[model samples]
Target: MNHASAFDMDAFRPHDHGRCRRAARAAAERECQARGLRLTPARAFVLDALLESHRAMTAYELLDRLREAGLGKQPPIVYRALDFLVANGFAHRVERLGAFVGCVHGADDHRAAFLVCRSCRQVAEAVLEAPPAALTAQAEATGFAVERVTVEAEGLCERCRADA
Candidate 1:
């Protein structure tokens, strides 16, 4: 994450989740239109499911949702949707949890850092301006091209901490 900037993640605080979900959908529509990408019903549904909360959800969980919605019963249905979403920067995969979350920020490609709650499994997303200096240095030394990075810090969220 960008250490120089101040950021408040709504996931860590109370906010109008309805408004956030609607805005994310609208942004996805606009982005798809601009990019000439097809936002299929299944894709939209998967995105909506991910945006419904800050918690990371596994593919099987998402597939269950799809099945309940009568979208698809097969695994490939959700997997393809996830593939498109991750490819277009509309969603992020939480490696630690082996799950996924919708991107809060718009479709613009940006580095993301996450604060993951160990107790509740909620994830707060933050933008990183660039790769960390130490990591970049190590990669350069090894002649490794760093294509992507997933930074996740695990701990308790405020609500969970207070409850404890």
Candidate 2:
């Protein structure tokens, strides 16, 4: 149940890692195609790396993978690819971790909450039926424009909690 390990799409457990990875890639390709966009090699590589693991990864960590793959050795290259992935809704930045994770469930722009395991730093994405009441009321009172909302709840997952 390591978050750094493969992710099981349906059960949220480890299973068919490669299949899930390919599905995510294919989904990204389809999304790009429908939008008249291209999933460039670098972007695809970064996304694939993220898809390979549920744990959030920093830019430098990804850059190392890119280097090993001969994609690019420069930090800017990785950053640019991340920018594209995040901007295009193929990925999301875990602000708390300052890292990135691939969007396997669907497009990134959707309103989804993030469950972050404090012990393992593994992130699980969850779709919220609606924005939290407090947040909505605060926004309304301030007349703040809300573009996208992602809630980050920190706690131990079942595996981690049990290990404790």
Candidate 3:
């Protein structure tokens, strides 16, 4: 399986998961309405599955859940749902893990950093107010325009560390 970097691992951990999930879904619904986007059944189900757990889920894993829920057992169904969620900013793709996670923040494609637990593969996201001045300056000096940045840190979570 793909692994996030050590820095990304710091973000994912136990917390008020229930509240987080509910809040994320509510925010997504509102954002969809505001943008004239429909939170269709498949998309909603995919988002709910992601929100229900902190762990990043692979497309296949999500398909299993969709199958159990009688949404659709086919791969295309889950893939299409995931694509819509990610495209709309309601979810994010964890490139390192090749999995998906529900965005805790609303549908804004701001610069986000991630902490991922290697053991459990849970992810937590944080928004960067601005790019580091040093990095920005360096890019400017090189006549390069900084467009996007993805910072991922990976490590063992407290529970995993404790178990070790």
What is the TM-score of each predicted model, taking all chains together?
Answer: 0.92, 0.83, 0.83
Best by lDDT: 1
Please provide, for model 3 over 24-138, each residue's C-alpha lDDT reduced to its tens digit, 9 standing for 90 to 100: 8999999888889888898999999999877899999999988899988899998888888888888988888999999877766555667777888888777666666777789
Tens digits of per-residue lDDT, candidate 1, 1-164, equal 34523333788888998887787788888999999999999999999999998888999999999999999899999999999998888898989899999887876676678888888888888777776778888998999998877688898999999999
Models ranked on lDDT:
1, 3, 2
Off by over 4 Å in 1: 1-8
- In terms of TM-score, the best-performing candidate is 1
Relative to the unseen true structure, what is the Cα RMSD of model 3?
4.9
Error of 3 at 98 (Å): 0.9
**TM-score, predicted candidate 2 vs. hidden true structure:** 0.83
Backbone clashes in model 2, listed as residue pairs: none
lDDT of 2 by residue, 94-138 (tens): 877888888776664555567777777778876566677777779
Per-residue error (Å), model 2, residue 58: 0.7
Q: Candidate 2's C-alpha lDDT?
A: 0.77
